[model samples]
Target chain A: MSEALVDALNPALFWEYRQVLLRGLAFNAYVFFSAATVALIVGLAAALLRVNRAWPFRWIGTLHVEVFRNAPDYIMVIWVHFVLPLLLGKLIGQRVEFSPFASAVIALGFVYSGYFAETFRAGIQSIPQGHLDAGRACGMAESTILWRIILPQVVRRMLPEAVNQFVSLFKATTIVSLIAVPDLMYQVSMVTQQEMRPLPLYTGAAVTYFAVIYVVAGSVRGLSERWRNKIYA
Target chain B: MDAIPAIRVVDLRKNFGALEVLRGVSFDVHRGSVVSMIGASGSGKSTLLRCINRLETPSAGEVFIDGEPMGGPVTANGERKERPLSDINRMRRDLGMVFQQFNLWPHMTVIGNVIEAPLRVRRMKRKAAIALAEECLARVHLSEKGTEYPARLSGGQMQRVAIARALAMQPKAMLFDEPTSSLDPELTDEVLTVMRELAADGTTMIVVTHEMAFARDASDRVLFLHNGQIEEEGPPDQVFGAPKSERCRQFLSKKLQ
Candidate 1:
């Protein structure tokens, strides 16, 4: 096993594998942005629903949260890849433009949005009633209170959890390789097919992922520190 | 006495469901005197102050602010009539209020909390509002702490910042509902000091306070509320020093508990 691994670790292999990794980053970035947008919408919508005491809206929010949160991200990816376009489109009776990249994000975002929504709901409600009263007492229109006072604090409070969700989405984007979007893991598989050495190829992909997430961790840590200082100053 | 009453409430009645809190309450505050409302818990002192600012609408009757109607109207038969949002906001801007909880925006810095109103409602330039905010902060002895956030400050400092935030709006009248009640005894002095200073400046403050000492010292007149109505109203010396109503005596005595 050691010899097999060492034999695969050629310098030529390193340089050749580098471009695949770069392509992986380019592909994954789209998924990351798409998922981020989707999760933000879902999370904020869920948070608003958490405040809704009305049965119908709250139950709808609840059903979204429960079904999405409990289900695995990979399974959703498979369903989006296979079933949704045909079945859901037929039900609606119109043509829908759904890309593999777009569908991958929808699935991951739907899964993680449930998690982020719970986080955001907790953050929003965790604010003391005094804050809302202050805004109302100041004669602000209701929108001003939410935008300036409530949502900023909600965003500040939710940032770390949101960053974590992004990381989760990034890793989960790799699952899209099975659906033929040519993401990071797909690049790894393609390289392995040519080199015929799974060891070096697996090691290369792991490093690329490790590098991506390592940078993410650093960026989020920096952001958390900066935000904490401003808010806690 | 020719000066118009800054606030006039006549037959004001408010209820949260079956519980009638302000039962036919009537009072008038002259243009530039400090009036303090004192009562035991649940006696509707805070509720009355809130009604003055229209934070809570009256179930019946009228509150007139600087000769303008607030809390809107109720029919002779007592149905609530609504006011347009724009008019209500206009009225609210003319009357600034402080709360027991201080309610400073935690997301904003001390200066941001102070300048928000002038920028939004008054539409003042950012630079001018910032200067005005500093001036207000200076009045509350928070000049050097403009960059500070509420969560970092002591309770006393936070409430003073709240007062500055209210004052920066340049309202005709100010209401404070148990403003220092949330502070510790040490912190209460800091808040009351600002109140004393505002009173000296003739700021026309309507303060609801449990601080009997401040009531006696700061107010031109003190109204003792019992069961949502003024049980007694007179100059502080007469009301607190020489009680007329049986309820007033019981309330002051109960404070000894």
Candidate 2:
């Protein structure tokens, strides 16, 4: 059985399929990075809007969090991929479509932004009221206070939670492959069907994900440690 | 007639819900004079100081700076009209306030705290703001600690940094609300010494303090607050030396003990 297993897991096969698998992994990387970046910005905007003095903005921000957070990621992604473009085309009288990658990114970005928004809001609230009073007493405008004092402290304090959110977003990238974006999971499925081999192919995919996660965890730890001293000081 | 006072509160009143913290409080601090407000805890001394700059809105009455109404208009019905944000900000620039807790921006270095308002509010050049910050820190005797963060400093050092941050704005009058109340007995003297020098240099100051010595020595006038009203006010020589009000005498006797 060992001999057969070794023979089945041939180096030649892996060498031949390396380019396709690597391309799929690269595509996964792109989707996760883009979605995570957009999620961060949208989350920040939503958090600020929720806390803003204006009634409309606060309402809109609350709606964003409520709608997206309660919905499932796969269902949202499927709608973005299939239904959104058709709706837009019918409404606008133009054939509107987003590429599979774009649809996946947008769907996942919105879904995760809701969670990030709550995390950021908690961070902002953790700051003492005295800090805001001090800023105002120094004659700083509200916008200046938010930009110079509040946001910097929030970002620093929220770094650990942000890392967790990014990791979750990275894992969620696998769901994009269901819409045929040819990410790592999609490649694994294709290779397993073509080769009639499940064990070695799935093992390879698992190892790839583990490696990426390990690197991410290490990098986040290093970055967080370096900031710990400077931020609270 | 007399020169206009730097700060005057006319029949100021404040309420937190049904609880009235200040009921019809009034006082005046002449330009370049130091007036000490001494009272037991919860006597509305801090609330009165805060209302002077509209940090806390008054439920009634008015605050005047240099004899001009400081905040927004009062309607005929007596509701306080909201002032334009820019106008409120402009008013805050001329009135510096130091808190009991020091309230230093812990994320910023000492010089950063001192220079922030000058750079952002006054829009001074960075180099010049730094120069002015250094001067303010020197005035508070914290010139060497400019690069240190607030958490790295002792409570005394942090309070002095707070004073330097206020002084850097070059405000017309400085308000000290229990500035030394959170410090050690020895540390209190350090802050009071800097304040004494500011008083000597003829800066208009309103200090809410528990330091009887500071009230007696550094202040030109002393106002004793009891139950949200001025129980006694006179030259410190009279108020502290020969107290007339029974409330004033009792409060002083307890404090001195």
Candidate 3:
């Protein structure tokens, strides 16, 4: 048991495959950034729809949020990778296939957008009606008021919640490995199979994820808090 | 031709479901004149003020600003059509409003709030807007605090910033909706002082207020609203000193106490 513990703790195997693992990690970053952008834009749209005066728009926004938020991430990834392409192919009368990376990004982006939508909506609702009234009283158009007055405050108010969602989004990127996107997890599993030693490979993968998430999330939260204080103080 | 009254309301009525908030209320605010509306809590003073700006659409009657009718053209049958949004927005620019809560945008510095309307609505040059904003800030005695955010200001200071923001628009008239009600006594005095200065400057103004002293001292004319109608209206001396209506007299005794 002592020998196995020492072997699992050794990170020599992880060090040996540094080049390939680093490349795989870079892929994870790419997917995270792309998905984060998608999530932010779509999430804001959904939130606006939910708050729209028309019932049809509100219902559509509600349906989108409920369907995506409740769906399991892994199942979503697989469905986007396989089933979605087939459905699209049938509709368009041609073969439609998404790359594993594309599927991973799309699935994760949409799922996270639901959570972001709620956060944005809460931020928007928290604004005093008096603020909107002031904007209108000054003769601002509705769109101008939204962009100038509403969105700026909403962004500040939603930062902490959005940061958490972003962290969760980054962590969720690991799920892409099952769809054969060459993320850090997929590289670790491949190295494990080749080396025929699960202990060090899996342990190394877990540690790497923990270290990256901790450092990155901690820095983002700290920086954002400082910025908020500087402005709000 | 005689100059048009700055604002004229003809039998304005507003109903929230079955509850009638303003029942055939009518009044005129002439140019450079100050009119103060005083009433009990539910007497629809705020509602009437809101209706003047079309923030609350009137269920009946019409408002004419500078002799131009609000809402839209009145058809032969006297039905008012909805005006284009752009037209309403353009008209609203002529009316500067200050609220009780001093609704300054939190994310902006004081100058930013003051300059936003001038820059956006008027489409003024940046330098011109800044110059105008500075002048307005100076008018409110907040020239030194232009860079500070609204959160850092005291209640009195924030209300002054709100006034500066409204003044930047160079509006035809100013509307005060209980502008000092949210402040403490000391802070309230500061805002009322600024208002008195504006009134003395011949700025057209319509004020809805619970401050009987302000209504009595600063107004050219005082209106006493009771149950959604103007129960009494006259010069402040006539209305406050010897009200014709018994209800107006009773209401003043409670507020003044």
Candidate 4:
């Protein structure tokens, strides 16, 4: 039992494949950034649609939020990787194949955008009508009021909620390994297969993810809190 | 006085569903004249002030600013046509409105709130906008608070900042919608002093207020609204000293007590 525990705790094997494992972590970051960008842009659009005066736009936004928010992340990734390409190919009258990276990004991005849309919508609605009235009374156009007055306040109010969504998005990037994107978990499994030592490799992968998520999330939360305090002060 | 009044309201009526808030109310505010609108809660004084700026669209009737019609022209059937949004925005620029809630944008500094309109809507140069903002802030005695956010200021200070914000547009007339209703007595005095100074400077103002002292002392004329119509209107002295309407007298006795 002591020998087995020593083997499981050993860092030597995990360190030996540092280059490949580091590269895999970098891929996770790439996927996270790409998906986060998509989610933010699309989410804002959806939120605006949800709050629109017209009924059709509100219905479309509601549909988008319900469909994506309720869908499982793993199933979405698989569906985007496998089924979406076939559908696209048939519609376009040509063959279409998505790279694993593209599928992972698109699937995760769309799924997370639903949450972000709700967050943004809540933030937008929380603003007092008087603020909009003040803007309009000053002769500001509707678009100008949205950009200058509405969005700034919404962004600030939504920051903490958005950060939680972002952290969840970062963790969700690990599921990309199922589609062969070679993220950290994927590399760890490959290394475990080669070395035939499941204990240390899987343990190391879990610890690495824990440390990275903890530090990144902590720093981001701290920085945002400081910034918010300064503005509100 | 100029041939064109600063503001003209013709039979303005507003209805929310089945309930009528304002019923065929009409009045005129000449340039450089101070008109005070006084009423009990839900008497539609605020609604009348909001209609003049098209904030709450008048269900019927017309608002004219400096001889130019607001919103759209009326068709033969008495329905008001909708004007282009840009035209309405341009017309709104001539009127500066201050609200009971202050409604200063919380994220921006005092000066940022003041200069946002001139910089964006008027497309003024950055330096020119800042200069205008500073001058307006000075007029409200908040020149030192330019860099401070609204959350840090007292209610009185925040309302003053709101006043400076409106003043930066250099409007032809200013509208006050219960500007002191939200303030404490001490805070109310500070705001009223600034408003009194504006009145003394000959700023065209339509103030909807419950401060009878301000209505009596600061106004060239006073109007009392009751049940969506002007119940009484005359010189401040006559309106306050010997109001013709029994409703106006009752309202005054209750408020002034």
Candidate 5:
């Protein structure tokens, strides 16, 4: 709370380096949003596979969720960033390198997709069997029942957990910085090293993350408010 | 009436693992006639209705919808041939089934539930689907509640919305499975009133109910099921007033009291 401490960690110190941090934050946002969207779709697919009548598909889904969920996320990111290109290149007979953004998105998308698969499966199971029977009686095909009757209601039931997944995914973006992705943390480290102002730089980075998380939580709150009264949550 | 039956179940049987729910049940629902099946809780009344639409695939026997064979295994001399899922879905479209729980899609409005089938399965135009939905809602006396979600409705209103959803399909026959069992007496009356109106409109219907009065008054013929078989069946007057079987007599006595 002291003025000197506040002045020492001056806001002016950040102004010159603002562009680097802003760009990094924007990249982080892009990575998080794209990866989270992919994770949601992949997760729904995995959940469906688990609930599929065929045993083979169910085993595939189970294996996917167990493997990705149990593996450490940073290690997976490293594998995607460092090892996959080599494998791909060997297959294609060329030296292939993935841009860090694509690598990060794929890695985090896979990691979070496992969590999302469980969430989605639980939500789907919570829906009464009678609901599906009603759809069947209405003469809806299985795919139609899934899209119209099942998934929408599942989303309603899983909104809170889904928001949590997004937040987790957003935080997970920090791991990409380890792979030379010039995200917010990378920029913060660069600023701190050059200026020797670790306190101000790290605090600014923390504040940026806080702001991103706050926005996500706020948006979810707003969206759920509209549906809370009407939906059978 | 010696016309083609709207729904005909020939020697239908269903088993859940070791539990045989419906055993060699047979019935014909003549067009424009309301047939009510009354029975004890475990007497296979609901199972019989479900078998008609292949909701519960029969272990043996065939169902005919307007003279067309439904999705049971085609048996010739005790040899069975499997039916495709597409065939079952197609056959199911002509059969509208209302459940005891009124399983309307909670995420959609009452009108959305009503219009969904016609729009998706039949690929009806939006304008025409909406009009038909409104008409069906009107028939259920739920025109004003169409835009509201099912979660907002009373038990009776929810069941009415369910009936409207089925009616919107414009099915040849409607199946009711203990449609009022979950409702309180007052709400039960509301649903029964709508069902009575549907029956009067000559909608071919097979209702499974505990309401003896509804079975007697609304239905032309009543089947009393006991131990997974039709213990007695006749004109409601004969079945209710002059039951010949001992099991039917005991069952009716317990229900009436």
Candidate 6:
């Protein structure tokens, strides 16, 4: 609480970084939102593949999730950053440039999708065959069964895990800064470089990350509780 | 009116990896009457009911609903093709089934589970769906507990909700797979009251049961399956009192006592 310690920390400098913070928040939200949107579709599709007894489809989806989930997520982020731009740059030349933002979307969307697919697959299969039979017996088409009957159950049952995945995806955006999208961590790195205050800068990044994740998780919990009451009476 | 058979299952055979479960089972369930299938364990009574709905595909022979043969390969371009899931789903709406386990959607409320099929499957309007759900729930005497989820309900209440759910579909015929086996005696009576009420309303039923007393009292006809085939089938007075086959007689003697 000493004035000297507060002054030394230079909390006032955060005001100067206001625009940069806004930009960082926007980038973070962009990557998380877009990636999560694509990931939800991929996860549900892959989960459907894993559920049925069909061999080839199951294997393709299974292999995709396993190969990506087991390998370090950082590796995919790095690969997308370094390798994709060159390959894309060659194919399209300067006419269609693949920026770090685009790379971040694809990398996060595709990679996290594999993990969430497995999660959704587990969620879907946990529903009994009788439930499905009941749906069919009611004359529901397979598409209706998937969207209306199956996915609602999947989303309601898997809300916490899905929310957890979102938090993880938000954190994963930090890795995209390596490709120079200039996210939150990148901003913190700039402060560290300018002020040579590694601990405080990194500390700020950590606090920011925790705050974002806590807010997200808390919202999910709040929604889940209200939904649970309406469902269970 | 003893017209055309409502359901005709003919020479049904099922084999799973060389183990034959239903061996040449054949039968007829008349319209607007209760047909009780009774047997010891592994006698294929439940399997036969599943075959009628095509839930368990027969390895050989066929099942016919209203004299239309189902559960057999279709001739397509001079080759036989297995029936698609869509075709089977369409065919299944006329029939509804209840499982031994109740099989209610645990995540849904008692009323939500009842109304879900009609709303999601049939695309019934929300207001109409809830009204129909209320009617069905009232039939089963669980009208007040509509908003409660299955997990909060007792086993008997859950089974009644399962019945109400099936009834909400307004099925042409309903199938019961050991409905009373899982419940305590008191709970069993509660479900039977619903079943008896359905019967009085002239809804057709095919029940697979171990409750010999109910079968004797409630069924218009009793089928005694032994070793995957119908050993004896006749009126309850004959099957329960004067069984024809040794298997039927023995099973009745053991089960009835």
Instruction: Evaluate candidate 2 and give its CAPRI docking class based on DockQ.
Output: medium
* Chain B TM-score for all candidates, comma-separated: 0.95, 0.95, 0.97, 0.97, 0.96, 0.95
> lDDT (CA) for every model shown?
0.85, 0.88, 0.92, 0.93, 0.90, 0.82
**How far off is each candidate at the interface, as Cα RMSD in Å?**
1.7, 1.4, 1.1, 1.1, 1.4, 2.6
lDDT per residue as tens, model 3, B1-257:
23789999999999999999999988889999999999999999999998988878899988899988887998899776889878888888999999988999998999999999999999999899999999999988889998998889999999999999999999999999999889998899888889999999999999999999899999999999988899999999999999999999999988888
Better of 1 and 3 by lDDT: 3
Top-TM-score candidate index: 4
Computed on C-alphas against the true complex, the DockQ of each candidate is: 0.51, 0.65, 0.72, 0.79, 0.74, 0.50
Q: Please state the error at residue A30 of candidate 5 in Å.
A: 0.9
Residues forming the 10-long window of minimal summed lDDT in candidate 2 chain A:
A7-16
Q: Candidate 1 DockQ category?
A: medium
Best by DockQ: 4
Against the true structure, whose lDDT is highest?
A: 4
TM-score of chain B of 1: 0.95
- Better-scoring candidate (DockQ), 4 or 5: 4
Give the TM-scores of the predictions, in the order they appear.
Answer: 0.92, 0.93, 0.96, 0.97, 0.96, 0.92
How high is the TM-score of chain B in model 5?
Answer: 0.96
Question: Which residue pairs come into collision in candidate 2?
Answer: none
Residue-level lDDT tens digits of model 4 in B108-220:
99999999999999999989999999999898888899899898999999999999999999999999999999999989988999899999999999999989999999999
Tens digit of per-residue lDDT, candidate 2, span A19-134 = 88899889989999899888888998999888888999999999999998888999999999999999999999999989999999999999999999988888888888878888
DockQ of 4: 0.79
lDDT of 2 by residue, B1-257 (tens): 25788888899999999998998888888889999999899999999998888778788888888777766777899877778878888888989989998888877889999999999999999999999999999999988998887878989999999999999999999999999888988888889899999999999999999999999998999999988889999999999889999989999999998
Give candidate 5's TM-score. 0.96
- For candidate 4, list the clashing residue pairs, or say none: none
Q: Give the per-residue lDDT digits (tens) of candidate 1, residues A1-233.
A: 69765677754675677887678778988888888789889878987887887988888888889999999988898888778887877999986656788789889889888988898888889888878777666777777777888888888887777777778888888888888888878888888788787777777777878898989777887978797677666
Candidate 1: misplaced stretches above 4 Å?
A9-14, A91-97, B2-4, B73-80, B84-86, B253-257
Worst 10 residues of 1 chain A by lDDT: A5-14
Runs of candidate 4 exceeding 4 Å displacement? A231-233, B74-80
Query: What are the clashing pairs of model 5?
Result: none
